[model samples]
Target chain A: MSDDKLERTERALDFSGIQAPEELLRMKRATPARIGIGHVGARYKTAAALRFGADHAAANDAAFSEVPEDIPARLGFFSVQTLCRDKAEMITRPDLGRYFDEEQKARILSSCRYAPDVQIYCGDGLCAPSIAANIPDLYPAIRDELVFRGISVGTPFFVRYCRVNTARVIGPLLNAEVVCVLIGERPGLLTSESMSAYIAYRPHPDMQENAYTVVSNISRFGTPPVEAAAYIASLIGEILEKKKSGLSLKQNEE
Target chain B: MKDVLMSAGIDIGTTTTQVIFSRLTIAEKGGFGAAPGYAVTRRDVFYRGRVHFTPLLPDDSIDKEEVARILSEEFESAGLRPDDMDTGAVIITGETLKRANAKEVAESIAALSGRFVVTTAGPHLESVLAGKGSGAAELSTRTGKLVANVDIGGGTSNLCFFDDGAVLDTACLDLGGRGIRIENHKIAQIFPGTKRILEAESIRLSVGDSADLPSVRERIENLADVMARLLAEALLLLPESPTLRKVVTNRLITCDRIPEIVTLSGGVADLLGNLPEDPFRYGDIGAFLGASIARNGAIRERLNRNTKETLRATVIGAGNESLTLSGGTVFYQEIAFPLRDLPVVTLPMDGANPEAYGEAIGRAWERIREDGETTAAFASEGLSAPTYEEICRLADAAAKAARQKDPSGSQTWVFVFATDMGKAFGQAFRRRMPPKTSILAMDSVRCGDEDRIDCGDPIGRGDVIPVVVKTLLFDNGERETI
Candidate 1:
């Protein structure tokens, strides 16, 4: 119910007797935050209150639900889980989410292709619904662009209860020159379908947090998935040419 | 500062010719790790030549060689050649533009002027630029209020009402200081508008009339009073008198809201509040006309006394303010620059459906097929924050229309949008389009059917497309293509 609601929600100016409704509609369309919503005397109007409740309800569902296994199965993405055992533990034990157990690590090393120029994969981060919504469009665009640009790419896969730093572990195991993780961001009041792309050049366990460069706020309400995919593909090309990402790349540009 | 280029402005008016050279600085304006947008950051006027009387032939047409010679001398004085200017404008304004040979003369001057002055002004453009250079546009922007400027020059009064720095409406009147020219205390010349006014008012004024006669002085003052009252009526947005309606050029003053302030520009503007002792000091009735405008009752209350500019408003605007930089993140392959005078076609977006794109693009391609023109620019006021599905639909609609129009796929296509979806749309077209089509899709530039656009070379690391949205229609009954 929440996933269907997230796809179909439409907003318009909630004002009555307005002289220029188009102007307010333009303003409302320009931003993701709540705007042009009607209010009662000292309170939100009943319809607006109910809509906000629906959105909050949707956000909570995104925070707790699991991405159906068929999503990764349809894309032929091999799946693995981090050290965290369940969603409850994943909520409180973020450090555990960044690493894999021995069996999961062995499975990744045995199943994935070896030492490609770039390795990309998906993760069910705090907002799992975003993975369901954006990946079908986003993943293929990145793959096609990289293939067209003649960059070698490794076999794609998925991770459950994953954090961003999981890309650091995967990069060293495959000996990839660049690693990218397309992960779902935490749900906000405005949207639960937002996603992010985090890229690292030759990432390792010793790398600092600043070693990763990030592109965030990807969704229909933000930079749409296909556009973000194109931008990320070009960014990866830049990283490969410079042989760096994040802080060192910024310094070299300066 | 990746781009610091010299720009020259040359304004040929009915009474005077002015020259100005300015240096424009282009810099990056977008946020870090984002599409790098660029804009002109600063403009410094390096030289301003002394105003000279516009040399005219005996037949009342501008002398092309004389204008070019003056510009050459001024360029030498400024220690620059005519070809040194990178970009600027040559604006032929006022009654001077009505001459039969005006377009030929302007083209000649522009040919000798600079590398690419890619801008031209009709009367409407004149009013917009004068408002900007006179500080009325800035005042309205800063205060977020309504402001108006009246540029009363030798042969015409150009009016622009600005709301928050955008032109709300524009109007021009056929009255100025030089309508009745005085030479050596005798009436030298009278334009047709003034002749009509004199006949209607039953005033006996003619060429070679004595300027020293008291009755003639009284009649001239009465004419000045009538001109002032007509201007006052237009400013107040009152129902126009027949005289006022007869003088309105192009479009009438469209006033939906009252202006909080009014400013002045052009040559005769400085004469107000400092009326000359000799009303014919400038060999014209300019002083009396200025005095009558200053004392007009209907618009006096909204007048701004400290206008930033008077004489050089139009020239300064043409030189330092006419250029616009395109938004970053455009998609183009190998292309040429300085594409000038292409008539525009617009594709307006319907709510949530991109079906309107096909009809609009079909109309444009039909024009192309008829004219045998190889290139045309298609513009859109695109959807803000559009979804990926919406953009793909738009792109598919556009590409299908292009394929239907030219199955050969050998023509160059240009797409300009008012929203930041150029790259996405461009990529979508790339996926669906044939390999032979040359495409240039850009965002954050606007044009209508009445406008022509010029694209200069990409600057700021090829992240910017310098654009000049110009008009080719002269107020006189013919077209001037540059």
Candidate 2:
């Protein structure tokens, strides 16, 4: 698989007119911290703390916001919940997480717009904090990319413990060429704010193991939230046009 | 003269022990002396240690001696004696066999009884038995064929792979029913009836920190989950071989069908009540084995398909060595059969018993000894029995430490070493994780860090024991290109 650079031509906007001193940029630059345990001692915690701050910003900033007003209006998409009562119920009862819960099912039935080229979802997943942090800028970036490509992203929703394969659970629920689920991964002591996106070609429950793709470690310390969102949108486009996600899809086939 | 011989066999295993007794008449040829004394009884035995009846420590102090003596006394009370004249065998297993001078103890017992013989079947014996009795036999009989068996016992499990009947590879583990019992405290807590029985018998079942009722139930369910996945991996190993199958204690449970029958002989099996009919349709094996010899083939086929030769599996297969086994005697041609080559498709596990426990145990014993060796054959390589909770603790501790170091969930991966190990631990972990997340396992696995060493750069220095989660992502520029 070749990691070829895609075309990018950035024109700097004239932010100089808005006026923030260039010296202020240098005054308080963010630094990442590192932490270590057992015999490693406390020296690493500084780096860890710094990293945590950056990760939190990336997760919580507007760049990663997944608020309601953003979709449908700008990207021609809507959102729904996994039909579960709440996060606590979803954790206690995974079967409910597998399907839409009563109220959630009804909400989706009434609110979700029908028949789009693809459907996208955001799940609190195992690491909801991470998803919340990344959604601000990431969601808009992905939506803009899809809209630019003239691809209609159908009603999207959030999931909990929403496995990569949970996309399959919603595949039949929404008829589309592809489904992308941006969910929280299990938390880690280093940073509980990491998120992952699992994209499947068909999104059927019976899909093969290799039928999905993942973009993990999407916090600031890992991949930048906006870059991850852009990549996810690109992946959705690939799945729609080439019809593939995981190992089976050749790295450069498309 | 319609004289019937009633005999029982007790096989004490690492994870669980079982006692089976049956009554069968030997057809007399020519003229018989003393009319065979109104029923010549030949009792077969395959037993495992139990939390209630057997001591937990690896040492053989008063408990070992008491167990042996109690068994002898019980037999005497059941109208069995040296003078009664016939054949009988006993398997002194696991830690009991590790006692200092354990073999001497067995020899002494054998000499004293005259009618009774003592033997030891190590961890490998079960695989050897499965090879002869299940799909291993078929794999052996066929040229250019491979087969595997994943046997889940109470305290340990076995993964035996074979080319034809010859053993290509074998792995044993400490994970089994005992692990399940300990890891899943909920099984005990949920079934207070079982706890009451244990309490009445003065058995202190240490379920660790999980003493609450809900946690106890969760653990039992976890055990079931582990059992199912481990069963799947064992079956997967024998891919393309129609014969390779997994074997449980009393009945054959295949992946294709729901469990139908189970024989409640061991400590865990005895406590089961109101199991689902959809899954356990055949009921109890103890009840089924007693009715006729018909049920033997179903389980036998399941066991024989993986052997180098499709031979009958039993401890008696050891009798093929021509040594006078500690147990009963078997005439030639009874078990001296050649192996077959072919995959043995499996039926799901079955656990149902409507007959008396005594009769059930007796019947299983008859099937065992009638085939000769008076034991179930298994593979030895890596076989050791540890509790399920112990395994989970090990995995959890390792996974947690790894996570702490690599919070991004990168630079490491958790690879289940043994198929059985993966299933056991994955079952427990799934209950705690998101539903879609599955435990990753190696194609052919091991127990300790040896697999990691073999993996080398794939798993660097920080790699933990029993888990080697990888972190390599292949990124190809297809999305933008498309």
* Interface RMSD, per-candidate values to 1 decimal: 4.2, 31.4
lDDT of 1 at A93: 95
Candidate 1 — which pairs collide? none
What does each candidate score in C-alpha RMSD?
5.1, 30.4
Identify the candidate with maximal TM-score: 1
Per-residue alpha-carbon lDDT of candidate 2 for residues A1-254, written as tens digits (9 for 90 to 100): 00110000001112233344332222222112121111224343343445445555643432223333443334333445554555566567666666755666566656665657777777766665565567664566566557756898776665544545567666776666777777776665345667777778777877786777777766654554644564566567777877777766545442
lDDT of 2 at A39: 20
Candidate 2 ranges beyond 4 A from true positions? A1-254, B1-8, B15-52, B55-62, B83-85, B98-101, B128-151, B158-171, B180-207, B213-220, B237-482
| Model 1 agreement with the true structure over A177-200: per-residue lDDT tens digits | 999999999998778988889999
- Residue A237 in model 1: lDDT: 85
Candidate 1 on B116-136: residue-level lDDT in tens? 564447778888888887889
Candidate 2 residues B1-482, lDDT tens each?
22333333444554333333344343332131110112123323332212234444444332556556655665565556544433344454443444555555456556654434345544454444434334444443343344555444444444455543555544444334444233232322212222332344343444353534545434334334333333433344222221112222222323342111211112222223333432212221211112111123332234332122121223233212101111011101112111111111111111122122223323433453464422221101111222333434543543453344334433322332221133233333323333333223221232221001112111111111111111111122111000
For candidate 1, what's the TM-score of chain A, rounded to 2 decimals?
0.89
